[model samples]
Target: MIIGIVKEIKSSEYRVAATPGAVTELVRNGHEVIVEHDAGTGSGFTDEMYEAAGAIVADEAERVWTSVDMIYKVKEIFPEEFKYLREGLIIFTYIHSNAHLDQTKALMESKCISIAYEDISDDKGQWPLLSPMSELAGKGGFLAALHFSQTINGGTGKLLANVCGVETPVITIIGCGNAGLGACELAAAFGNRVNVLDINHDAMMDAKKRLPQNVTFMFSNRENLVECMKTSDVIINCVLWPKTRKDHLIYREDLKLMKKGAMIIDVACDEGGAIETCRSTTHTDPIYFVDGVMHYCVDNIPSAFAQTASATLSNATLPFALAIANKGVKQALKDDKHLRRGLTTFDGKLTLLETAKKLNLPYTSADEIVSTF
Candidate 1:
């Protein structure tokens, strides 16, 4: 199989989907690897590194996209790349089909075999591909809060960490999943009062066992959430909102309950999903003021720490990518139930039920489609 690794073109997105080590592994497996020139430069990888790993370096992204059997990317396909979609090319990436309606249409119309890394699950029901990036995003989100809370950034001048002769600022984190735990670990380590809220008792208990005394576990509910908003200096939302759900966890009216200058770092930057006011921001303009409260909702927070994020993400996705490369797309999907779960589109059909329901389009099961082929 010929696999192509293209440089990320999204604004301020620096993480490349593939690394030199990852390419080396692919080459070792007898798979031809093509990398766009400077694809890994943003992540501190030079073109010579990829060449040393036995990857063919293409001068233009078009050569990598047009000549490869499969495209490995970090983000969803953009409008410019939509023209590259063909009948049989496989796209293995974080194709958030529910969020991008036009991309979904492009995949279906082009009959591409597309797999969404975010939707892939392990036996324990955890998103393996999405977990590494989510963890980084969570930690980065807290860092963003710390930076934005400084007086220079138009914040309240209260540091997130405990200071001598100064009161410790409170930080409330919603959801105790991978992202929330990441945020909690950082926030609590800084000697701040960290409150982690989750409706799942088992999850909260699990977090409590790992976290220090500075962190408090709270049940997520309207009353508790409201109280956190009123008292906490920073609120970090880590909940992965459902694509089909119209309701928001934090409504527009809830902003008034928060302290003035308190910022919200939405690790789960689902537009109009978890937070009513959250629209995907870029690293260029990461913050916006809404009702006197600051919002840090960069869609790709992990991109800010490209080198670490790329390596971790590459490690997570490599096994699955190798599976597809070795066994072919259809055979791999048919063999691995977890991999099949990640299928967004197969042979021009909409295989992701969530995207279909969100868009009110017709749905086809990946299993059903793969079986026929």
Candidate 2:
């Protein structure tokens, strides 16, 4: 099959869909790869490197889109590229349709076989593909939040880590999942006084047992959450609802209770987010203030370091990509139940029930869809 890798056009989105090592493997598997010019430059992989691996470089996205049987991407499609979409091409990427209604509509209208990496599961019912990125975003949340907490940036003017005899920063991580745990780990490493909250008592207990010395675990309830937010210096929103719209844990009104200049970095912003104040921002202009509270909601947080992001992401996706390419999506799903769970939208139908219910759209059972495939 002819596969295409397009350069990301989103703000500061430097991660390419394919790398030279990935291209080399595709060639060995007898697949041709067409890369948009300089797609890997930001990722520190030059065109020559891809050529050495037997991939062709196309000058424009239009050429790659028209020629490839499947398109591999790191992010969702933009409105400008919506016109290039064809009826039957396969799109393998983080469709993120739940957070993006317009893109969801476009993909359905295009009638393409689209799969979202975020929705894919492993045998253990974990999102392996989304994990690596989650790790990156989890760690990044602390760094971004710290910067956002400075008074110059409209933050609460508190340092994440304090010197001896000084009060340590009060940091609250509003989730105990991968992203939340990730932030907690980093925040603790920096010597911040951190509190980790989760709805699951077992999870909270587990976190308390395993968390670093600087971290604390607490049960998440409206009262506990409100009090934590009011006193915390930095808040990391790292909660997710998977393929559905995220339930709001923090309303805009809640911002009034936060200390002046308190920072809130919603790491799960791409998945719609736990905080009501969160909206997608870009790396170029990543922070904004709402009622004297700072928010960092960059959708593609991993894009800031393209090379590492590409290598880590490609590792998780390559096997799945090859599976779909070799066995085809239909046969592949039959052979691997885990991959079958990854089916979000297939040939214009919303096979993921949660997405359909959330959007109030027509739906099909994934099991039924896989059978037809």
Candidate 3:
């Protein structure tokens, strides 16, 4: 099987889907790896490195896309890439079908096998492919707050860290998942008072054991949320909002409850999902003001740390990619039930229930499609 690696073309997206080490692994397995020229440049891997790993270096993305059996990527397929979609082509990537209706349509119309990394579940019910990037996004979200909080960056000029002879800053984190824990770890390490709120008692208790004494765990109720808004210097939201839910956790009017100059860092930048005011932003123009409250909702926060993000993401996704390559998409989906959960589209049918319900499209179960194979 031939695996293609293409450079990410999304705005401010520097992370590559595969590193030379990952290519080496594919080559070692007797699979032909085709890497587009400069595909890994943003992640600090040169073309020579890919060549050293026994991958064919194509001068153009078209060559890699056309020649490979499967296209391994980091971001969703853009409109420009939509023309490349064809029957039986396998796209293994972070295909957020529920968010991008047009891309989902293209995938279905093209009859391609599209697997979403974000939807893939492990035996523990955790998103293994999405976890690495989520952790990085959480840590990077806090760093963004630290940078934007400075007066020079047009922020409130309030320092996010604790200072001598001054009151300590408060950082409020919503949810106790991987992203929230990552943000809490950084916030508490800076000696700032950190409050982690979640409805899950088990999750909160687990977070409490790992976090510092300065960190407080609270129930995620309306009262606690309002209180956090009024007191916290920074609020980091890590909840993954459902695509079908129309209501928001933080409404547009709720921004008024926050302190003046306070900022919100939404690690899960689901537009109109969790936060009513959140619209996806790019790193080039990451922040905006809504009712005088600053919002930092860059959709791809991990892209800011391309090298680390690429390495970690590649490590998590390589095994699954290898499985599909070696066993073929049908056999692999049939064998691994967890991997089948990621199947968004197969043979021109929408196989993901969430995406079908969100987009009002026809639904086909992955199990049903795999059984037919």
Q: Model 1: how far is 146 from its true place, Å?
A: 0.6
**Model 1 segments beyond 4 Å from truth?**
none
Q: Summing lDDT over every window of 10 consecutive residues in candidate 3, give the lowest-scoring window.
A: 154-163
| All candidates: TM-score | 0.99, 0.94, 0.99
Model 2 CA lDDT for position 69: 88
List model 1 lDDT by residue over 1-373, tens digit each.
9999999889999999988999999999999999999999999999999999999999999999999999999999999999999999999999999989899999999999999999999999899999999899999999999998999987888999989898899999999998999999999999999999998999999889999999988899999999999999999999988888899889999999998878899999999888999988999999998888899999999999999999999999999999999999989999999999999998889999999998888999988887886
* Residues 1-373 of candidate 3: C-alpha lDDT, one tens digit per residue: 9999998899999999888999999999999999999999998999999999999999999999999999999999999999999999999999999989999999999999999999999999899999899999999999999999999999878888889999899999998898999899999999999999998999999888888899999999999999999998999999988889999889999898988888999999999888999989999999998989899999999999999999999999999999999899999999999999999998899999998998899999999998899
The candidates, ranked best first by lDDT, are 1, 3, 2
Enumerate residue pairs that collide in model 2: 155-261, 156-261
Residue 371's lDDT in candidate 1: 80
Cα lDDT of all candidates, in order? 0.94, 0.83, 0.93
Q: Please list the residue runs of candidate 3 whose C-alpha ends up more than 4 Å from where it truly belongs after superposition.
A: none
After TM-score superposition, the amount by which residue 22's alpha carbon in candidate 3 deviates from its true location, in angstroms, is 0.9
Model 2 stretches astray by more than 4 angstroms: 205-210, 242-247, 270-273
